[model samples]
Every structure is written in structure tokens, then in C-alpha cells.
Target chain A: MPISLPDLENAIRTAIPVAHLEIEDQSNGCGENYAIVVVSDAFEGKTTLARHRFINEVLKNEIAEMHAFSQKTFTPKQYEAHLQKST
Target chain B: MFRAAFRSSILSTRPSALLTSSPSSFSKSLLIARRNLTQEAKEKILDAVNATPVVLFMKGTPDQPQCGFSRAAIQILDMQGVPPEKLKTFNVLEDPELRSSIKEFSDWPTIPQLYVNGEFVGGCDILLGMHQSGELESLLEKNGVLPPIEGEATKSSS
Candidate 1:
């Protein structure tokens, strides 16, 4: 069975307790691929490697079944800057 | 592929087959039998990692990145103003064994894995984030991988 978007968010939120999340299903309803943008205090003071490792650890089971999983993680401040830049 | 590498290492080390009659050469078959593929792959992977400060095991070489993520990674390193000589990329697509075994070596189930000074950095997405935050540059400096960039160079020297 293909993994669902809610399932992906649920897994990340369970692990991270994220302040915000934006998930895009890039698999066109196949639910096999996704791109995620996560913002949370959990990322503060963490290196990119550590952050990715944490998310990977959290979604290990789900990710094993996924064909493509790409993500960009941000601390609250970084997310704010990214938001401001986008606007 | 492991066998191929071992064979090439044997050939390169002993260019003169006539003068080279070492017991080690005779024992190569035994070594091959005793040594598992995973162990050999790990050794090769480590060798590659240690070969350069920034090693990217990607789908293709820097000049012709086959995938979008690999291309993105090349661009990130480029943005850091790193010299091309300092970046060594192994095309995993050329060797199926290296491709699959690299995932096991890094414990990362993805292509386009980046290694800095024998340590695994995260993949392209992580790299992009690090680049944007200026963390990758600092990490390069911390690891003694790259020389400090323009403004930081003067500060460090002064």
C-alpha cells in the first residue's frame, strides 16, 4: 500500500512536534513521493545533518516504502526569514 | 566491482609481473574468497572519502550530474566558491555495487550523498538548507576542508 500524505505529516509531527509544516505530494496521487518543509523549535541549534537524521529516524519505516523523500528543515527564525524573503 | 578494484590494485602495485612473485599475489584468490563484498566495498568507500575533503557520491560526475538533486548539490558547492579540484565525485551509476553498498555504508537510503572529510553530511536537501543558512561554509572551515571565504579570510588571518 502507498503511504498517504497525512501519514507522512503524522509521522513527522509525532517525532518533531513541529510548529509548522508544508507537505507537497509530488507523486501525483500515487503517494510514493513528497517534498516537505518543516519549521520547529526542535531544529534550533541542530545541524542540517542532525535534523535530517532525526526526521529520517522518525520516518524510517515510512521512508523505506517511499520512492522519493525530499525535505527542507528550518528553525523558527530561519523559517521566518524564509517567509519574509518569499513575500 | 570489488573484485575488479582488487584486481586493479594488484596490477597497479605490481606493474612488473615477471619480477613480482609475491606470496600476497598468490594469496589473492584466498583473500577474495575470505573477504566479503561488503567489507571490500566499505574499504573502497572510505578510500574515496579520504581522497578529498569534499566527496560527493552522486549519480554522475560534477560536469554531468545525471539527477536534479546531484545537480543541486554541485551548485551548492559551487556557491561556496570551492575549487573544482577540492571536490571529488564518484559516479555511483557506473558501478551498481558501489551504488547499493554506499547506502549501506552511509546508512542513508538515497543517492547524492555528500561526505566532508570522511564524514557523511546529509544529502542534497540537507545541503541546500545548510547552504542557505551559511552552515555549510562554516562546516567546511571547521573541518579544514575549504579555506575561508573572502571576508572571513581576512578576519581569520587578522
Candidate 2:
């Protein structure tokens, strides 16, 4: 009756073909809380708030059953910059 | 005999009252405070923030902002003459605990927080407004560092 991390990851991947994605189960295995980082060109022209809205729209169904969701959405360019810096 | 009976009843009820509270419930506040942190983790985070004048808790670092807000935040600060080296950023993308703890620390639900003197100065919107009004310059002035604003070329465009 609860959504798993893989299920949440699938939902995000289905909605947006992101270059990179990380979903952390912050609910202490309670299946109610999640934190996600998604990188894609889909967010290129969007504002932060808009990107968040896009995710909310895509996950509207799962959200109803979820207790807390923390998200970080980035464009490909930004993700590339991040990747370069870390290395 | 009545006095002895009363003494026995009083002594018996005291142990039951104490037994009903578990060790956790007895130290509820301490437990709640410890729920999200190990003492060392909290100290490390606090130390990191305090050591850096401008701290950003974002999805990624300055060179790589993992979120639109994070990118915008870094860009805005850079545009204001606060270079990447002048800032200390934490990538919440890497650490889930730091991400949630930061939100709890600042009492602000948003990321890309700006801290000067280990105090929260607000997020992207506040930074943008301060940069435009030249208030950011004044704050930097008080800190004994003055740098020219970098967005002179795009000042009127926005």
C-alpha cells in the first residue's frame, strides 16, 4: 500500500527523461517521505518554482499517498557544470 | 496495623507510576532532540557554516548547481561580485541528512540559503532584490570588503 523508492524513481523517469536522478527514502523506511534530485534538459527554460510544479503535476497521484517530498530539479547544463566541478 | 497498611499501599503505587513511563518517554525531549542528529554531525555542520562567510545549501555546488533555484542562486551571487571562492556551498544532492537538517536549522524551507556572519540573509528572491537596490554593497561595506557590482552590463535589462 506504500510507494517504494524505485516506484518513485520510475514515476520521475517516466515523466522526464532525466540525465541523472537520485531518490532518497527519508521516511526512515516508513514509505511516506522522499527526497529526489533530477537532472534533465526538460528544466532548461523553466524557473525553479515552475520545475517544482512540473514534478508535482507528474507525481500528483503518488503525492496524495506520500507524506513528504523534497525535490531538486536541474537542467542539463547546470548538471554538467556540477559534474565538472566535482571532478 | 492501619498505619502499616497505608504505608504499604503508598509504597506499592509509587513503583507502578514510575514503571508506566518508559525510559524513552521519561527523556522525551532529549530523545526528540537526538532523533535527527548525532552530536558530532550537528557540530560539524555548524562549524562549516560558521567558518564560511557566505554559505549556500543547494542541490549542488557553485560550479554545478543541481537545481534551477540553486543555479539561479549561484548566478545571482556571482553577478553581485561574490565569486565562487568567496562562498561555501553544500550540495544537498549528496547528503540527505544535511538537506533536511539545513531546513530545520534556518527555519526556512527553501534552499540556496545565504549566510553572512553565520546568519541567514534569505534566498534567491531576497538576494536579487538586495543586489538591485545596492543594499548588498552596503552590507559588504560593513564587513570591510568592497567589490564592484558585476552585473553592470545587464543592470537595466532585468
Q: For this target, which candidate reaches the highest DockQ against the unseen true structure? A: 1
* Regions of model 1 farther than 4 Å from truth: B1-37, B142-145, B153-158
Chain A TM-score of model 1 comes to: 0.93
**Model 2 scores what on Cα lDDT?**
0.64
In the order shown, the candidates' Cα RMSDs to the true structure are: 14.6, 16.5
State in Å the error of residue B17, model 2.
34
Could you tell me the lDDT of residue A1 within candidate 1? 88
Candidate 2 structure quality by residue, lDDT tens digits, A1-87: 788877777766765567899888877888877778889766766555456645654565576577666677778888787679779
Q: Taking the tens digit of each residue's C-alpha lDDT, what string does model 2 give over B17-129?
A: 12222332222211112335566777877898788777888888777787766788788777767655657888987998887777556544567677776767766655665
Residues A1-87, candidate 1, lDDT per residue (tens digit)? 899888878776655557899999998888878888889776777666666765665565677788788988888898898889999
Number of the top TM-score candidate: 1
Cα-based TM-score, every candidate = 0.74, 0.46
Q: Least accurate stretch of 10 residues (summed lDDT) in model 1 chain A?
A: A52-61
Candidate No. with top lDDT: 1
Measured as a fraction from 0 to 1, the native contacts recovered by model 1 come to: 0.17
Q: Which pairs clash in the backbone of model 2?
A: A82-B64
Report lDDT (Cα) of residue A83, candidate 1: 89
